[model samples]
Target: MIDFKVLSDYAATFTHSENDLLRQMEEKAAEIYIPIMQPSAMAFLQQLIRWRSARKILELGTAIGYSSIRMALAAGNDTTIVSVERDEAMIEEATQNIEALNLQERIQIVAGDATDDLSEVASAAPYDLILIDAAKVQYEHLFEKCSGLLADQGIIVTDNVFFHGLVCDIDAVQKKQLHRLVKKVDAFNHFLSEREDFDTIFLTVGDGMAVSTKRSCAEGER
Candidate 1:
């Protein structure tokens, strides 16, 4: 197999350069050790939004609203995003970032645990696209909640499915906590692959991404 890291780096050279605001956000996220989406993966995500013309997007995790902002910008001016984050600090920063871009109307940050009841999120049912980039251990739980909120033929994209390639070699992980997290991520991959209601594909995009499209009832029945 080709060296993916090298290939990804080379491919990123062709993607559009980050603007001043995005560049600043990238720098700040790096300085603070905030885990934002890789540029390559983010490019793929933006393309998905453009391809689907996604108008309503729900992001399970909003670290600093980086991905949410990117999606809104690509999905068109009419697009709206509802992002959930439990961390108070992160939510504050993300809100500031969204406001800085004058995207307050396009992106709304909901303060709460994604795994818990989000009545506000539920009220805005049937999102066209849902991005899951939350805690690895709770991926399945998040998926369950997102499934019901997804519109017919909607897509759910899960990030960090590979867990830094550790899922491929769990035995190599010495830390028990990390090992358990990797195992859970691996199990979620299996669970998602076997889902009856959606057709899923795993991509080698940055840190690995899993894109699943809801199958129509007729297709599921068949």
Candidate 2:
């Protein structure tokens, strides 16, 4: 196919404006150039969890804990979040943020490469919801690793699947700053679409988001 992206109801995707906390922190992250999920996307995530009745949530990136915190608060008392971040500094800030929210018991932050040794993080696996927003090239690896960790009815939601619209035609974006990202997202999308274990849907949102659910998993897998 010429276009890697299938047309989606752009208007209906996690559609909502920024809330107060989202607006304020988004400004702060911008001041420091600390990337976080857009408010609209977070808003959608909130809807997603509520609709999916998410009980356990796993996040691949914890840039400033903005989205993590948002997800936790929106999930309420029953939900627990385990977010992974590679950067030490980011982890420190996220730790403090989690504590400040009095969510130390509800949210856990792990420090280390998310893909390097998931064996440790795997303890939190079989998650009902998994949100990935870290390194672009590792999307496929994360998906595979997280698959066995997902519950039967779990969903894996990934952000930045478009990579600034480059995923559609890497030849044109190969020379751009986002060339590698575009190529990787395309690779991940291609890999997922062919898999029978999961049902995947790619939506064009902030950068882009792909929501996949574990369908009939392969033999010897969950």
TM-scores for every candidate against the unseen true structure? 0.96, 0.85
Q: What lDDT tens digits, residue by residue, belong to model 2 across residues 45-148? A: 88898888897999999987888888887788887898999899899988887787678888888888878766557887779999989888888998888887
Best by lDDT: 1
Give the C-alpha miss distance for residue 64 in model 1, angstroms: 0.8
Candidate 1 lDDT over 78-174, as tens digits, reads 9879999999989998988888889999998999999988888998878999999999899999999899999999999999998888999999999
Off by over 4 Å in 1: 1-3
Q: Where does model 2 exceed 4 Å of error?
A: 1-21, 174-177, 216-222
Error of model 2, residue 179, in angstroms: 2.1
In model 2, the Cα lDDT at residue 123 comes to: 81
TM-score computed on alpha carbons, candidate 1:
0.96
Error of 1 at 187 (Å): 0.5
